[model samples]
Target: MVANFETVTSGVNLNQYAGRLEQLGPALDGIGAYAERQVKLAIAQGRKLSGERLAPLSPNTVAEKRRSRKARGILRRDGGLLASIQFQRTRANEVQVGSNLKYAPWVILGTRPYKIRPKRKPTLRFYTADGWRSATEINHPGLPERNIFEGAEKAIGPFATATIAAHLEGDL
Candidate 1:
């Protein structure tokens, strides 16, 4: 025989919190997928707008630099605005890193010169077989923010449905 445990009731429905947490997973997954697609689209868009002649560094090197200098120049011109959207909390994909989000608005400009200090000791240096590289790295940091945004948006529609379901279940 199973022992019946007496339950205490609270003003807030306990099921709601559990339901929210359960719903969070799918929301996150949808967000992740959206973010991945957006990054790829952005990369493609950037490459198209660059108008750079992509020539082989050598006949053997087939891995083309997707972004051209002209594209980078254009990106740099508007990078400040992009950075602002990236860092803004109100923006769909804005993310906050260490320090504060305030720095984001101007950080993308690349206008600030990086200061080089003399090394205290001789640094070990070696030349790799590969030559120079492009500025476009595959890392997309906006993904998490995108996921959160999507999750939040998804939650609104489901919240009402879930609440109604809970009420009906309790009635039975």
Candidate 2:
């Protein structure tokens, strides 16, 4: 006598998988928003750290004294540059955090000695306690690299990983 066995297979509907895949866009949006917040916080912390690293303003001259009084700290005078730092998502997978300050790059990456030409060709004058003083053309010694932007970038990797993991697990 010969015994025969029949094999049975079950059909799987892949449409459910596709449906879950479709939810990925919205999930990524949520994660992007979360990452943006994390990055902004990192940048703020970096700004504080950068401020601490800067050289203190000297109160030698009257102008310097007045500036010291009005300014919060070294690079944070009037808080213009620091306040300009902002974050925005440019694409689904891209986020940019930066400042609109024209000198931001110069601050981040130290520059070499460069010539200075004022728009006023005849004479450059600056405010002083007594009156306007004639400014002389002098090669400016560049600032040292502060690494504030690097600090912010370094914080993003771990944050992105954790955030993505949490999002995948539905904990985000």
Candidate 3:
């Protein structure tokens, strides 16, 4: 009696898995949009919570005269910076989100002592509750740092995990 033994090897095909990975661009785009919206919402909420007005005007104490038209506020009056906030796919698997405004970092982190100068005249004149006053140099106390981005960043991990899970489960 003769006995023979044979060994066989099997290979797994990963083309389907590769195809699924290649098709993740749209899903990643969706996640990026979600993150951008979430961050924007957080910033808006922070603005509301901080009681920051869209345009704040200086007080006028004069009995018959109109108050000086001075605008104040972190939010843009023209909606340019707010509208410029956006997210874009920087790479095949990467996304970048931020505002295009030059003053965005200053608004977020605030500034130190700065000088305030008159726009037109040499002397800075303003009408306060006390009375009208003129100042050669005004020291401006910078705005307090608002943690809008920090708040949004805290939610990113959960948002990404849930979104990816849903996508993989066909629930997204």
- Candidates' C-alpha lDDT: 0.29, 0.49, 0.54
Error of 3 at 108 (Å): 0.9
Model 1 stretches astray by more than 4 angstroms: 1-17, 47-111, 115-172
- In the range 1-172, model 1's lDDT, one tens digit per residue, is 0001111234757564564433333333333334333323332343211232222122212222222222232222334423322211222222221113354323222234333333553432222236443332222222111111222223332432444345435421
Off by over 4 Å in 2: 1-68, 125-133
Which sequence of candidate numbers ranks them by lDDT, best first? 3, 2, 1
Relative to the true structure, candidate 2 reaches a TM of 0.58
Error in Å for residue 119 of model 3: 5.0
Query: Residue 140, candidate 2: how far off, in angstroms?
Result: 1.2
Clashing pairs in 1: none
Q: Work out candidate 1's RMSD over C-alphas.
A: 16.0
Tens digit per residue, CA lDDT, model 2, 23-59: 4454455544554455345344544222344443333
TM values, all candidates: 0.25, 0.58, 0.63
Report clash pairs, candidate 2: none
Whose TM-score is greatest here?
3
For each of the candidates, give the backbone clash count: 0, 0, 0
lDDT tens readout by residue for model 3, 16-130: 3455444556666776787677656655544531234222322332211344432233443445555666777665556666777787777656578789988889899876667
- Model 2, C-alpha of 170: deviation from truth (Å): 1.0
lDDT score at residue 41, model 3, on the 0-100 scale: 65
For residue 42, model 3's alpha carbon misses the true position, in angstroms, by: 2.0
